[model samples]
Target: MALGVVGASVCLLVFLAILSLDIMGFLSWKNQFPVDGKTVLLTGGSQGMGRGLGKLLAQKGANVIIVARDVKKLQAAVEYISAAAKSQTQRFHYIAADVTSEAENIRLLEEATTWNNGQTPEIVWANAGAAKPGLFLETPLETMRRQMDINYWAAVYLAHTTLKNWLYPSDASAHSTTIQAPRHFIITSSSVAWCNIAGYGTYGPAKAALRSISDSLRSELNLYNGARRSTATTTKPAPYDVKIHAVYPGSILSPGLELENQSKHPVTHELEASDPHQTEDEVAAAAIKGLERGDYMIATNWLGQLMRVSGMQGSPRDSLLWDTVGQCITSIAWLFIGPDMEGKVWNWGKKNGMPAAPKS
Candidate 1:
């Protein structure tokens, strides 16, 4: 009984210390970026998470530009967002363009800037993505390529185009005079990017690529902003405050999710059954909340949070103490839970007979 009391006291002391550190860290972090009156450009806004985010941003008084391939759906989404607008000045627009095409993404940005009175978007959401779930051998090469193009390359193109257009200009004179606002670029990855399951071979890798790119951009932007601020000649405007956020969302109930579920392996479903499945609105709310808090890494669910801490690779830390605790938990899970899960997956695959790889 005395030992138990000592252990409990130690645990309470540790918890209090962590809580104090988190509070101090939160206070010292960058100020929250406001969404009100900002122009936000969102891709894949025709439905699901994109549409939900659009509505929420609109309600927050942001001028929202939604881009997607489906004209009908885009139009509907715009109308819905317009109805949700909190202010008369909060305009909602739609662009019908394929984000998978670099040229089309350029065109989409051109139109968005033109509509926003030649100003670039203050917040950019690279939310367009697709998944083709199957065993590595069964899925077609073209299908995997398409997923990469849509999920990875499209985001790259948009981020590149946005940064080039907003940060750099053809004329050096104009670049010096540009008054920049705080900018945020958000990329949507999946929880499976870090926690690779058997059925998500293509999708997992693509999202993982996105997370890597986001991390790289975050580092580069930090350096760029620091250098520009340090070398200011009193002529150029202060360096742009650009932030990159990577989101790892678990199961969401949306049209895209439903389609993914239809083709997903039974084992994949069984393994993920315990994780909470959020609605589109729930995901959007969580994502926006994370953004408001200036979190470098956003996880929409507990499972995503676990995967994030477990597989974290040099990303910005939100809370050192909590993150360390999560990492410890992840290590234990890897030693026990991971192996058991892998064994189950192997057994299931062997019993069910996975499809053979396509011929080269």
Candidate 2:
């Protein structure tokens, strides 16, 4: 028994060492998602994680364009991003518009492309979303519709518009002999997308839908990517390869979280007490690091990672072999954790009546 335990421990250590090397980019010669000198258009960039990501990208030498409904906040965010820019040449701009409108998203892309000197942004991030936590029966249908509009449909609109431009660029004929950097479409999801909690009826489904979209796009885009590699293709493929990524962040300490807390039920709070709360900058940094390392689904914290592995389903893994290993371990842990969560919620309801219903 002692020898068996020792052998298992040694094997685990070796696997971890290899996984760390892959995640840290030591196994790759070049950064997978290099943003230097690339144009990035980020929605919800006026504040919170969006603003933090804008600043970080600017520091990494990306020309950033932030979109939000608040002109004052957008201006402030542009200033923040400009200050963090690596060089004076790095540009920062802002667009004040509501992303929930499909027409507005189409116009927004046109404006951004014109501002970027007729070049479409190589990196697009759909980061504008809000959460209102409430019980399913108690939540209003209007609130659910609004959540789905901003969280799911808005991303759908943006992704459609961006991918169209990227796949058929105006200047595709001018492509150089050298391959250009691949375009990236990143979506921001929540840890609750994978792990269900009682109070997120209006919010969780939308985030999960976003994750689902990411999964579909990840596979569907492969057809286009494969076409690029074939010499027998009759038509020209996209100018560059396309990559899709989704970032799953746990509870964040930001304006959005404060707003969610206002509507979050007491029971919901207690149930999620174990989730780690990270700052906007911390989450942004971790997400960017994952992008640099070419991760498909990025988790901002340990809890988020656990949730991600729990509901991985058919989504592609960043490191297949290592991720499978991690998933096996997480699956074993979830055997206990999953039932424990259900029990806690059940006991809470028995101990206390339904949480206070929202006043109509």
Candidate 3:
């Protein structure tokens, strides 16, 4: 009798383990993706994270559009993506316009609408902006204004333009031979949005503003009713609102990190390491994965859900401590257990004249 009881107990334990594993697998799969042919446009697509995303989406059968002020560099990027995606039909486009201008933003969207091979682009990633890492008093006022122009103003202007032009509802027939489509707008944010760092007098504020705007837009769009025929001029979404996702990440290793180190405020923010600088290709892969899964918050190098849980708690100091420690252990675990592909915040130790974050 005792042996039979022990056998039953063992069977119950095994069943519970399998159930738990299945649940966890579903949660993880919630953010993984199947390939999507949806069109995507990336601003600041000349290099770094933008270029990375442009290539990944193109490779995934997406019609990718890249826009920046550098024409020669843009052509080079097109060739690079063409090689990466290996698809002759993977259309690559570029429009040279400074995003800060409202007229320029509108013109870019108009161009995007026309370039879609008679279809509308359904995804847009606004990754253009300036980040001057310096103390508030040390950085020039003009630099701060420029950050706001590119970061906050340009993003919303593009979001509004994309909606009004490409995603807007029209009188087309429901029976028409058109594919059912949903649009999405993704904005790049930072951890600085939640906690302002010591040297982000300029960079932090602009990201915070972007965070606020993205939240408000998401809330309003979610409340919209599509059946209503009323014309709302506000930045509201249609009944089936386009998904707006905010990607909050820490330091990214880009060539711009080299320039940031060279600026007059040399020892400003942290820079990436030479060995483990997370390539732009990796960042782009993670982003496309997150977008296809419709994740609202994608922390590319997420250590664990602990950071998000900590962010939900009150007390600024406590939040910072939780985030810093969790991120460290999480990153360390990646090195030891998983692939080092998860994002890591590293220090350059003044070799490039960039200020290193005080040792965690």
Best by TM-score: 2
lDDT of 2 by residue, 1-360 (tens): 999999999999999998887664557656787888999999999888998899999989999999999999898889988999999999989998889999999999999999998888999999999998888888889999999999999999999999988876667442555787889999998888997788898999999999999999999999888888999988776668889999999888999899999989887998988778898899999999999888899999998887787679888767666678878999999889889889988999899976676677
Which segments of model 1 are wrong by more than 4 Å? 1-25, 28-31, 169-180, 232-239, 353-360
User: Per-residue alpha-carbon lDDT of model 1 for 44-142, expressed as tens digits?
Assistant: 998889888998888888999999998899989999988999989788889999898999989998899879877677789999997778768777888
lDDT score, candidate 1: 0.84
**Candidate 2: residue 202 lDDT (0-100):** 92
**Superposed model 2: Cα runs more than 4 Å off:** 1-26, 172-177, 354-360
Give the distance in Å from residue 222's predicted Cα in candidate 1 to where it truly belongs.
1.8
Q: Score each candidate by Cα lDDT.
A: 0.84, 0.89, 0.66
Quote the positional error of residue 162 for candidate 1 in Å: 0.6
What are the models' TM-scores?
A: 0.87, 0.90, 0.71
Task: Give the number of the best model, judged by lDDT.
Answer: 2
Worst 10 residues of 1 by lDDT: 168-177
CA lDDT, candidate 1, residue 96 = 92
